[model samples]
Target: MVDVYLFSGFLGSGKTSLLLNVISQIKESGRKPAVFMNEFGSLSIDSDAVENGVPLKEVLDGCICCTGSEQTEAQIQSLLEENKDIDVILIETTGAAHPVEALDAIYSPIFADQLNIRGIITVVDSKLWLDRSRLSPQIRALYMEQIRHAHLLLANKSDLLTESEMATVSMELANYNEAAPVVQTIGAKIAFSYIEKVLHSTKEKSDTSIISGKGLPLSSKLITFTESVSRDDFEEWVKSLPETVYRMKGYVPLEGSINPHLFQYAYGMVSWLPEYVKMTPRLVIIGEGIDSIKYE
Candidate 1:
């Protein structure tokens, strides 16, 4: 069975540069890799990036973040049909396509049973990553999910980081995922042997109970509520929260919980699937400023 590797990162994070390096390695190893790039609202800039003889199967449409599940599947299937013996696939997702959700869309029932979902790699731009504060936690959650689920992560653009800064980033990453290897590279120029060394473990079956629902077009607003009480009383109050909250999750220590508890409400839906850690739970309600709390 052929493998599919998804290489993604935020905008200007050297995804094309890294992909070129990997494709070159695949060529030298007497293997063929079909390349797919979904550059949202643009085209692939492969002039300086491609040096190898490997033919790239380019798809320069918008990011497959939401649509194109069937089209993306068809593109891959067509490649396989053209080259029935191709060794692997390398898909470079557009920066806007939250990498995990993009992968989920690909692995839907339509395509999930066909291809082996090999890996998802995210490259972080060290210089500007920390300053990205457009709903930092939400963005970071997506980034961290990519890192947490990856078999390998190449922290490309190492030149931007000092030795000390690299150490700090490494430490921070380790807190969440020490199992995956973190490689430092410049312009994603890591050696081929490093990538080929590990037989990437197969992806765990994705767990997204909420993804199947059609997300209503919501004009999201942020409202915050803070409370202080014993952990027991705090949790009791949390369970009784008005259902207008749409995805409120953060860590604020309550008076009694030994650890910080995180809570979330997906608008009208109620889910306690994610195990809650003990912490002060502050709720950020995302709903209309209007009184829409009666729906529940």
Candidate 2:
């Protein structure tokens, strides 16, 4: 049976970083891995980050838990049919997705017999969580739902917070999720070996006691740039963004640069990495009440 692991977290919680690391570790251990990535936008930006040659299936324009369950099951069936030797399948849910509904989607009877659900591993941004009170009540509740159902919790971005802050975050997370173990991490980094031990040894299945009746109202907008823009101008635009903009990521064509730069923004933090090859210059902005934000 193929072991399936579900990754749950809110927007910009470093799910992609953790997925990349897990993929590398699985490869090093001589096991074949497959991926099922879901995106809230029409275009899939994070799927580009997955290493080449890994069997990948993407569910786009919707969250898998709410409106994409049938689509997800079909994709997973195709993935298994195409790759008969896959030892494990890693599913990375959209940041706004709920864990219980995602697990429900995965329990399709058609392929349920062929797979063993390892567990749901959730990544929590320690900083955003600390400031969650500023978010709308709906979003805050969704965040708690994700954490409450995890089989393992990663207190990601631990380096950004002081020792006292981390201690507080760890204590709160442990108290809220006593069923799961909380691990403080930098960039969502944790020993994959340890993850295997915790998940593989767990005999309990996913808890569906509190499933979300509906998906969150989060939305995404895809912005395409026809030409390179000045780095200073882009930075200025980012600075002018409203706090409602939760996450933004894509390849940006920068003036005077030979290749497009990979740009990421999350919770007021921005980063740019130089890319060797030119990618389509586009950005996917996810948030609430952001339809009026102009990119020009």
Candidate 3:
């Protein structure tokens, strides 16, 4: 059976950075690793940031916990078929995803005997969490859902908080999720040995039944445009996007540019960079109640 690792956390919680470190550790131990990335938006920002040479399968424009489940399952099947010798498959889910749904999607009857779930690692931002009380109830529910199903919770960015504050954060997380063990670190740096130990111990405690929830109504929209727009106009449009649109990403061609820029937006953050691979402009927006036609 192939070992599967699902990394879940809130947006901008350092999942990508920690994943890079984990992948490096796995490679040093002479294990072949494959990655499945879930992006809340359509653009492929985090996939590009991943170090070169790792085989990548991406599910874009939706969270794997909900709307993107079928595609994620298919991608996992494809990855296993293509990389017959891979030792482990690491799945990085969207920040807004629920681990319960993620587990459901990947736990297919066809792959029952072939796949073994290692554990779900949830990353937390100590700094941002200090103000979690002021966040909207919807966001707080999403955050709790991600952690409640974790096998290990990584309270990252501990350098930003004092020892007492760190303890408080850990205690709070424990209140929401008592099943998982909490490990605090700065910059999401964790020793590989500790991670392996956590995986083994969590597996010992896991039950045969999958976790279930009422389920969130997450949706996605993919839009393609044959025509290219000016860089200035594109930037302006991105800045004016609605908050209901949790994430948006895609490649966009400029009127006079040779290569199109890959754009990604999450929460209130927006970024655009020239993509190495040139492709037609295609935007994907994932969230609740998004009107794709309005953007077109």
Candidate 4:
């Protein structure tokens, strides 16, 4: 059984930056890690922050997150079969993905006993959120869905807001998801030491079982950044993102290899280690307040 963590965030939420930071921490700790990335674009991205890049040929060759659940299930199973050394499994879901569906796809019967779903981390863009209020109905619904299902809600890009504005955004998030802890971070930066440790057990506060509401998009203005990467490069890129967009994720293919790397991020905070087969490295950082775009 492997420890699995699902990293989810809307477009431009800094998921990639977070993935890189978390991966470095995992490596620094002397733990072998494999990153599973689901790039929604044709030009697969790679993470070059590390010396050893993650290969992509080994990962599912398509859109596993949005295409449906069966393939996604097969993707996880296939990875387990190909590489058994994976100590922890980190899933970098697509930006357009519904956080719940990402979890459901991996929670298949085959993986149920083998993998433990520690928690769900959702990233939200404070700037985008403010705009969500004025977006069309379909878009608003999507924003609500993301916030409602978060186990840990990252009120990212806090630097963009004033003290009073920060409180207002925090209050708004609480209204939709009072269950998760809404922490502010910069550059999606966070210490990776406790990511998996903290996620191993689900926090009672972020439970979505009590949530009621069928997700229905009210607008199409919701944004997301879709790409792939090699685990190593992904690492540096994520840390760099701590200053860029809001979120990023997907797998990174190590250079001169076929096996794909996996990772994810929210705002600027990183969570969980990427694992599959064998790999390990150590790096950790915790950003205070909202994540700055530079972290993206």
Q: After superposition, how far is residue 281 of candidate 1 from its true place, in Å?
A: 43
Candidate 4's displacement at residue 124, Å, is: 1.0
- Name the runs in model 2 displaced over 4 angstroms: 204-296
lDDT by residue (176-239, candidate 3, tens digit) is 7776778998878998679777676534211222111112123334555577788788767776
Best model number under lDDT: 2
Residue 18 lDDT, candidate 4, scale 0-100 = 76
lDDT of 1 by residue, 250-270 (tens): 344546445544444444444
- Taking all chains together, each candidate's TM-score versus the true structure is 0.61, 0.69, 0.68, 0.62
RMSD for all candidates, in order, please: 14.8, 16.8, 14.1, 17.6
- lDDT score for candidate 2 against the true structure: 0.81
Quote the lDDT for 159 in model 3.
Answer: 90
The TM-score measured for candidate 3 stands at 0.68
Which is better, 2 or 4, measured by lDDT? 2
Candidate 3, residue 295: the lDDT equals: 45
- lDDT of all predictions, in order shown? 0.56, 0.81, 0.74, 0.56
> lDDT by residue for model 4 over 1-296, one digit each (tens)?
47666677877887777777777777787776666666666555633332364422222344554564566777678877777777766677777776655655565533444554556667788888878868678767766776776667778888988889888888888877766667776777767655544443332211111111112111001111233334565567666543423333333335544433334455666554344643222111112112212212
Better of 2 and 4 by TM-score: 2
Q: Give the Å error, residue 86, model 2.
A: 0.5
Cα deviation of 95, candidate 3, in Å = 0.6
